[model samples]
Target: MENYFIESNAYNPWYNLAVEKYLADYVQKEEVILYLWQNQNTVVIGQNQNALRECRVQLLEAEGGYLARRSTGGGAVYQDLGNLCFTFVASEERYDVEEQLKIVMKACQKYGICSHFSGRNDLLTDDNRKFSGSAFSMTSRGKVQHGTLMINVDVNKLQRYLTPTQEKLKAKGIASVSSRVCNLQELNTGLTVDGMRAALRAAFEEQYGRCTELSLDMLNNDKIQEYYKMYSSWDWRYGRSPECETVYSHRFTWGEVEVNLKLHNLIISECKVYSDTLEVQFPNMLEGLLLNQRYDIQNIQIPEFHKADEELAKQLKETIMWFSGVWR
Candidate 1:
């Protein structure tokens, strides 16, 4: 058995993971995987999930520099220095995701952490506080099973960073930032994130095979660049939401902005912004600018208007700037 490890000491969450995904996506089937815990903060969204719906944009942007939308379907998960992430990349012909998860579970059991698989992909403690969540992406070369292991994370920050989920609210009743969360340190008082990562690495190596160090790729490629564009853009993140709906509205200066909109899968299907600002000729200039394109917004082009007059164009630019200022 051959193993490879990508040690990212410091990097943005999305890029670091993307680097791993890109390289792992093409590596040989005999490859096994191990990655050390990194300090960068990140929000990893399920592949089919809308980035915007999974997290609070204002909060995430303020704390975590970038958000990553994965190519697998699951709920959003928060990761930081306090978290230890691991991945198992094996040839699909010889590997099983469930067995890979068991390899991780054995590691947790060593620390007296009674863990069990929850629902489709979560690994929860005996008391039911989730400590690990798993997701998989398959390539012709193989399949990768990746998940996060909580060691001593700031639960408060986790809540503050993630968007509210009705599913979470209904099931756990721990919605929003104010909720119950625990770390291994709180439970055992001896395990650190680094220690946990190292222990897991040893366990995986024993189970999968020998491990080797792999150099990190820093250059931009088409596939990685595309992932960055898709992940960073608001449309791909929020517009693809499955829970939220689109919002539309128009009104005079004093009255309500009577919003009329269509929301599907928590994403804006269509939107129109209107306001009687009277300062610009095209008060509805944002009509074509979607109020909610979410993930698919990256593919849409900003509308073009054929205004020939130089003075009119300048005036329009000023008005547009002013209009944006009001919203800001």
Candidate 2:
């Protein structure tokens, strides 16, 4: 198969992620694509993770770091100009995780950095310090495997923004995040982001055929812009998180209402309504009504409370929608 190499000039995390999704989902050509991109200070969370639980929101916001959600399943990651992100997009028939990892390993070897795949999806040096981590997603037409290579990352910023799970920390037997990760530039003072990119490009050309370089303008079309809108929106980035319970309380002119919801697979599995002004039967009416229903207020069916309580019902609906992660 032919090889297409795309180096994204856009540093916006949303734009780079949009380009990755567009290539995986919309590109119909049967060829292997090696996409290299970088983002400014940003924290990218996995599709299945809870952003609030995985990141230090206050620190991220104060440091001017953006948060994004990728279409892959993995833990959260922090990125900056010092980090390099690579994505391998190919058809399902040609999807090979080991082969793709080998390509990255070969590139690292070119810079005199010896690393190997460790555990599930990490590339670690001989001393067991991790420098790269990867995640994967399958599209209808193909598959995408993307990873981050730590070149000259700001370790302090990485630790400040990302709050990894306790289980992950215990598994690595590391007490702190800074102790677990190392930068390529730290290992080899001569290695730069540009030099690493060159090494990876050469490795791709050696493994695949000649490379066809694609420009940022080529990807800035209307279709990609549409995808960028989706990726950049708050709803797609945070609202599409995995099913979890969330409590929301709102006080209106009428009264206060607290909504407790248990969502399973993005569907409302259980819901409880508490309000001071709502009728006695209002909570019961909402019990099975929204069961197995996705958290969309527009599509939700609201039963008629007493005509006098219309305002209360409206407030309750709005609060429930807000708890469902729908932002107006």
Alpha-carbon deviation at 45 in model 1, angstroms: 1.4
lDDT of 1 by residue, 123-202 (tens): 77778787777777888778777788788777776776674433211111112222234577766778887667667776
lDDT of 2 by residue, 85-200 (tens): 99999987777889888889999998788998887689999899999999898888889999999999998888777753332111111122233888998889999999989999
Query: In model 1, what lDDT does residue 274 have?
Result: 48
TM-score of 1: 0.72
RMSD of 2: 7.1
Question: TM-score of the candidate numbered 2?
Answer: 0.71
TM of each candidate vs. truth: 0.72, 0.71
Displacement of the residue 82 alpha carbon in candidate 1, Å = 1.2
lDDT of each: 0.60, 0.77
The C-alpha stretches of model 1 lying farther than 4 A from their native spots are: 37-39, 165-181, 217-244, 248-253, 262-269, 272-328
- The C-alpha RMSD in Å for every predicted model, in order, reads 6.4, 7.1
- The residue pairs found clashing in candidate 2 are none
